[model samples]
Target: MRRVLKITLVSVAGAALALNTAACGGKKSSSGDSGGGDGKKSIKVGLAFDIGGRGDQSFNDSAAAGLDKVKKDLNVTTEEISAKPDEPDADKESRLRLLAGKGYKAIIGVGFAYTNAVVKVAKDFPDTKFLVVDADQCTVSGSNVEGACFSEEQGSYLVGAAAALKSKTGTIGFIGGVNTPLIQKFEAGYVAGAKAAKPGIKVLPAKYLTQPPNFDGFKNPALGNEAAKGQLDAGADVIYHAAGGAGIGVIKTVGGAGKWAIGVDSDQYNQPAVSSVKDHILTSMVKRVDTSVFDFVKAVADGSFQAGVKKYDLSNDGVSYATTGGFVDDVKAKLDQYKADIVSGKIKVPTKPGA
Candidate 1:
């Protein structure tokens, strides 16, 4: 059965928090032909960041990384509108339209949360190329738009297994920004991973909001700590936080607890989480969002843009398991085989619950 992608379409500002900053590059656009310019097509690429803004160490950062690469490699100038967790859909949609009107050749929305906003913008601005990460194909598959989906579970499974192997307790937890298909993919893979390590491993889940559209759900570290503590109290020894900035709490809560947490999207092992937890960070499930974003920009610049769903996974080098934390060294041999199995179709990863 095909599952519909239920997404949160809007965000509003809530508590404000500070995080480190990183940016991607692009060139300014002119009234000349849309090929940027004659030489390199001096096109302006616009990116609207997800609620966590710059340093959620997850999707936003990943997208920025890709944009940074494209900006340098393709040499295009870029601009971005950083969304507050509470930024309204109307406000964001206007920004998208303005960016398009400003002669931006491509405008990228970094998360599925932008689905409601981007869909309308893409339709109105058919002349401009639009790309949205993790969007529902039923809603946003236009001739001018592209959806970049990922095999999150396939990669998350490996990291989940690594966390299980590194844990003393047979319990792990998952923290998500919202209980949507994308985050559900993370939760399901985590459960599968814990099971693969040792069947019957307990998995805990934490959701920040009681309702949907709370994109700030990813920006709350205090709630994350509370959730992590709840899991720890229940005897969870490791946690894989897919909760964006909320992950900071997981790191802070795990301090000296003799347990660990896996960071998602980026290598959180080298971040403040690791600085606080030492070697407690097991690994991160990386979605090279930045690579894909920049790839799209470069594609348009080269006049080779592909519309519709473009899947990114371990096979495409779009998504992969990163063990930069050294916590997975003991299981490298096993992981190598797992990677092979996924690549060769020997192992089938699930996209939904009970799948």
Candidate 2:
């Protein structure tokens, strides 16, 4: 049984931490500063969060979960920086520089927006290891920058299969937060998976909350609701969204319309913010950002830190479809078979739709 994804479940415990205390800029604070008797020096890891920050209950929060695990299990100290919506690239650069400037051994940028900043900053701080999540665009060429990218399409494929399998109307919908290569990965995988499950299944045209240069799409639930309503009105009984916080609206609309919704990044079924509509959430395309984040920090702490691109995929347990709601139980065996085939390379999940 060769593992496809590197699945390591880390438990996150504690209040959410962020470095956005100041109105105009980022802030940094220490957690678990208590002394350790082992006499091994503690390492400082800094996280620069994406738009929704620590409490978005999605992507950024998943990264925070990894940080919390390090704080509890490894006894490491950490600091977090939250990103403001539509902030300039310079601000992102400054945040990354700040973390590296503060003597932190490893500084992590939580989203693809940090791609440019990580590439530019890592050149100056050669001693500091930089990790970027979701930004494979960041060049690791001759620099100390490592990207922790996930096979989002592979995970989306599973959920798409679930959506097709579970849809009673023979139609499904997908909503993306922003129009980018990354989000497109989610769209492509989902559509492919859906069709694979049920040939000739009608997939509605994918909708975007916003395009690039306007990332409010990731944070705006109003937009998500509107997009979802459009889908439901078009006869889509099941919708899957990779819209971050905005996806909350999708879930709400699905529940209100008596349809089904699939979540992203983190498990929406476990989130209190979406509790009211939990029953409507069929499952989540769980992208384990925490595992990647934790692995980087842990490697540095263990004196085995390396700089390069590390990918998580179905083959490595880096991505999968969640089953917390148990709505997919009937299709679990079939989904598991698909998972096995993908892991065995018999099925190659497409990163681009129709590819």
Q: Pick the candidate with the highest TM-score.
A: 2
- Model 1 local distance difference test score: 0.72
The positional error of residue 130 in candidate 1, measured at the CA in angstroms, is 0.8
Each prediction's TM-score versus the true structure: 0.85, 0.93
Candidate 2: regions farther than 4 A off: 1-13, 17-20, 24-26, 33-35
The 10-residue segment of model 2 with minimum total lDDT is 1-10
- The candidate that achieves the highest lDDT relative to the unseen native structure: 2
Report the number of clashing residue pairs per model.
16, 10
Deviation in Å, model 1, residue 306 alpha carbon: 1.1
